[model samples]
Target: MNRYPTVLTIAGSDSGGGAGIQADLKTIAALGAYGTSAITALTAQNTQGVRAIHPVPPAFLQEQLEAVFEDITVDAVKIGMVNTVEVARVIADMLDRFKPGFVVFDPVMVSTSGSKLIQDETVAVLWQELFPRVDLITPNLDEAEILIGGQIRTPATMKGAAIQMVEKGCRAVLLKGGHLVGSTIYDVLAQSSQEPLILESDYIESRNVHGTGCTLSSAIATYVARGNSLAESIIFAKEYIAGAIRSGADVVTGYGPGPLNHSFSPVSMQIVS
Candidate 1:
C-alpha cells in the first residue's frame, strides 16, 4: 500500500485560522500532502494582533512529538513560531531523534508590531540546536535583521545575510525580501553548495497578507516531500504564495490583514511508494 506524502508542522496555533498551524495545514493540503502538527503554543490572536499566548508544557509537547513520529511516516517537517527556549529545545531534540528527510524552519522571531517575539537567549539556543538540524531556514527581512544584527536595505545585503546564516550552520537560507520598499518582492535563496538564486514576484496590494510566511514554508515542505529538489520546492512555493495572495486580494476576513486563499489551486493528495 502507498502512503500520502506527509509534512508535519511544529508550530503554534492561531485562533484566527490564518497563520501558524492553521495555515500550515491548509498549505500542505492544498499542495497535495497530508499534514500533521505538534503545537508548541496557542495564541489568542486575530488579524489585528496577538492578545495572549499559552505555552504547551514541554512534557506534553514531547508526548505529541512522540505520538506522531511513532505512528506517522512524516516525510518533511515545517517549523514555525517557537517562542520559548523549552519549546525550541524539545523540537530540536525530536528532529535529532526522528531525522525527518526534510526540515524547513521559519524563524518567526518578530511580531507584526516590530517587536521581538523570542528572547536573546532563545535565539542563541535556536542557532545552537535547531540551526544545525534543519535543511532550510526562512527568515523575512525583519527577522533576518534580528538574526544578523544588521539592517537589510538592498538586494546585496539580503544575499549577504543569507550567506551569513548558511555559515551559521543552516544548510540553506531563504531570506524573504517582502518588507523591502518596492513593488517587486525579492526572495533570495542561498545554499552552501550553489550560487544564490533570486526569486522575484509582483507585490500584490492586499490586506490579506497574514500567514504568507507559514503558507510558503508549508508549501515548500509539501513539494519537497513530493520529491522536488530544494531549489525547485522554493520556486514552486513562491509561485503558490503569489497566486494565493493575488486570489485573496479583494476578500475581507478581518479589519486588519487577512489570510491568503490557500485553496485557490488545490491538488489531490500525492501518494508515495
Candidate 2:
C-alpha cells in the first residue's frame, strides 16, 4: 500500500492556474503528499483579477467529498473558497463524519484582485459551523479584519485577532501579516491551550504572490500529514514559501500579481506510520 501522507484540497479552480486548486495540489505534491481534490468553485480568472465564479452544486460537492473519503486514507485536509452557506454546512457535516486526521482551513473571503469570493451570510456560518472544525485557519489581514470587526494594521492587532479566532473555536490561527505595511512580515499562530507562536520574516519584494494563502495552508496540511508537529509544519511551510517568492522575484507571468512558482522544488513524500 502507498504509505505517503495523503492530503485532500476542497477549494475553487483558477483558470489562471495560480491560486486555487492548482496551487493547493502543487504545494501538496511539492511537500511530498498524495494530493486529492474536491473542487468547490470555478473562477474565470487570470493574474489580473477574477472575472467570474461558478460554485459547484451542493449535492455534487457532497458526492465529491464522499468519493475521496470513501477510497483514500486522507491524512490531512486543506479547505478554501467555500462560497456559500450551504456548501459551508455540508463541509461541516462531512467533517463530523470522516473526522480527518488534520484540517487546515484557508477562509478565503476575497481574491487577490479585489473580488468577493464568499457571501456575507456565509461569513457568519463559517464562524458558526466551520470555525470549530478547523485545526488551523490561514487568514490574511483583510480576512482577519472581517472576522474580528476591527482593523489589523499592526502586529499587535494581529496577535489580538489570532486570539479571537482561537476564542471562536479554531484549534489554531495563522493570521497572515502579508497585507500589513512593514519591512518584516509576521504570522501569529495561536491555539487554545498553548501560548501563541509568532513567526517573523523579512518581506521579499515580489508581485508574483497570487495564491500565497492557498499555497501556505496546503503546505501546512501536507507537513502535518507527514506527522510533523504544527509548529514545525508552519516553520517549514514558511521557509518553502519564502524561497518560492525569492526564486520567482524577477520572473513575470502576467500583467498584475502573478502566481508563485509552486513547482520550483519538490521533496520526497513522507511515509507515515
Candidate 3:
C-alpha cells in the first residue's frame, strides 16, 4: 500500500467553516493530501462577521504540534491566523525544530470583513521569527500593506512588497491581488533569487469568496507535498481555486459571503512511482 503525502494546518478555527482550519483542511483533502491540524484559536464567526474569539493556550498549541510531528509524516505545512505574538513565536520555534519539507504561511492578519485578526504586537514577532522559516508566504494586499508598513495599490507595488518580504527572509512570497479593484486579478509570486512570476486570472465575479486565501495556500501546500515545483504548485492551485470560486458562486451558504467548493471532486493523491 502506498502512503499518501500528509499536509498539516496550524490555524484558527472558523465556526462558519468557510475559513481558517476548516477551509484549509477541506482544500488539502480536495487536493488529494491527508490533512491534519493544530488549531491556534476558535472564533465565533459567520458569513456576516466575527462575534467573539478565544485563543488557545500556547502550551496546548505546542502539545498539538509535538503530537502531530512525532507520529504523522507531515509532508507539508500550512500555517494561518496566529492571533498573538506568543502563538506566532511558538509556531516559529516548532518550525525551526522540525523543519517541515514544504511550509506555506498564510499570514492571516485580517478577516474578509476588514477586521484585524492578529494583534499589532504579534506583527513584529511574525516578521522577525516566522517570516524567515517558511517556504512560501501568502499575504493578501491588505496583509501585505500591514507587513511592509506601506500601501500596496498597484502591481509594481505588489512586486516591491514581495521583494521586500523576500529580503525579510521569506524564501518566496505569493502576494494575492484579489482585493484590488479590477477585472483582472494578478497574483505575484516572487522568489528570493529567481525572476518573479506573475499569475493573472480573469477575476471571477462572485460574492462567495470568503475563504479564498486559505484555500489557495492549502492547495499550494498540497501540490508541493505531491512533488510539484513551487511555480507549478502555484499555477495548479490558482486554477483549482478559480474553478472552486466559479462552481460555488451561486450556492448560498449564508446571507453574507460564502465559501468556495473545495471538494468539487475527490482528487486522488498523486504519488511518484
Candidate 4:
C-alpha cells in the first residue's frame, strides 16, 4: 500500500491553536505531509502568553509514542515542549527503539511573553540525552543562548552559538535569529563538518508571530519526510514560513499575535521517489 509522507509531532497542546502541536500539525499538513501527534503537555495559552502547563505522565507519553510507531510509518518526527527531563528521556528511549528516520527537536525554552518553559535539570537531560539523538535541533536566539551558555545578541554570535550547539551533541543546529534587532533576519544552519548556511530574509513587519518556530521546524520535518535533502528541506521550509508570515501579516485572530496562514494555498501531498 502507498502512503503519504508522514511526520509526527510530540508536543504540548496549545489551547489557543496558534502554536505548539496545533501549529506543528498545521505546518505538516500544509507542507504536503500526513500529520500525527503525541501531545506531551496541555497548556492554557494564547497569543499573549502561556498561563499554565500540565505535563503528560511518562508512561502515558510512552503509550502515545507506541501507538503511533506501531502502526504509522513516521518518516520524520518533530519534538517540542517536553517540560520534564524524564519525559525527554522517555522520548529519547522510544526514538532509539523505533529509529525514526528524521527528527527535528525544537527547544522551546521560553515563551514570547517571558515565561520560563524548562527547568535546569530538564535542560541538562534535553541537551545530553535528546539533542544528540535527533537529526536537527532548532533553537531560537534565547534558546541558543541558554543552551550554549553565552549571549547570541548578534548574527556572528548566533553562528558561533550554532556551532557550539553542534559541539554539544547536535548533529545540526538552526539557530534562529528572529530575536535580534535588525532589518534582515539571519537564521544560521550549522551542520557537523559543513559550512554554516546563512538564511537571510527581510523582516516581515508582522505581530502575528505566534508559533513561527514551531511552524518552521515542522515544515523542515515535512520536507525531509518527503525525501528532500536536509539543505533542501531547510530552504523549502524557510520559503513556506515566509509565505505563511506574509499571508497572515494583517489577519487578526486573537487580541495579540495571530496564527500564520498555514493554509494560504492548500497543496496536495507531495510524493517523491
Clashing pairs in 2: none
Instruction: Please state the error at residue 128 of candidate 3 in Å.
Output: 1.0
Models sorted by lDDT, best on top:
2, 3, 1, 4
What is the overall TM-score of model 3 with all chains considered together? 0.97
**lDDT, model 3, position 55:** 97
Model 3: per-residue Cα lDDT over 1-273, one tens digit each: 567789999999999999999999889888888899999999999999899899999999999999999998898999999989889989989998898998999999889987789988998898788888888999999999998999999999898889888988889999999988999998899997888877899999899999899999999999998889988899999999989999998999989999988888769866543
Candidate 1 residue-pair clash tally: 0
Worst 10 residues of 1 by lDDT: 110-119
Could you estimate the TM-score for every candidate?
A: 0.97, 0.97, 0.97, 0.97
Flag regions of model 1 displaced more than 4 Å: 113-115
Give per-residue CA lDDT, model 2, range 1-273, as digits (tens).
Answer: 547789999999999989999999999988889999998998999999999999999899999999999998998999999999999999999999999989999999999989999998999999999989888899999998888899888888889889988987788899999988779999898999888878899998998999999999999999888889989999999999999888888888979899888878888877766
Residue 110 alpha-carbon offset, candidate 4, angstroms: 0.6
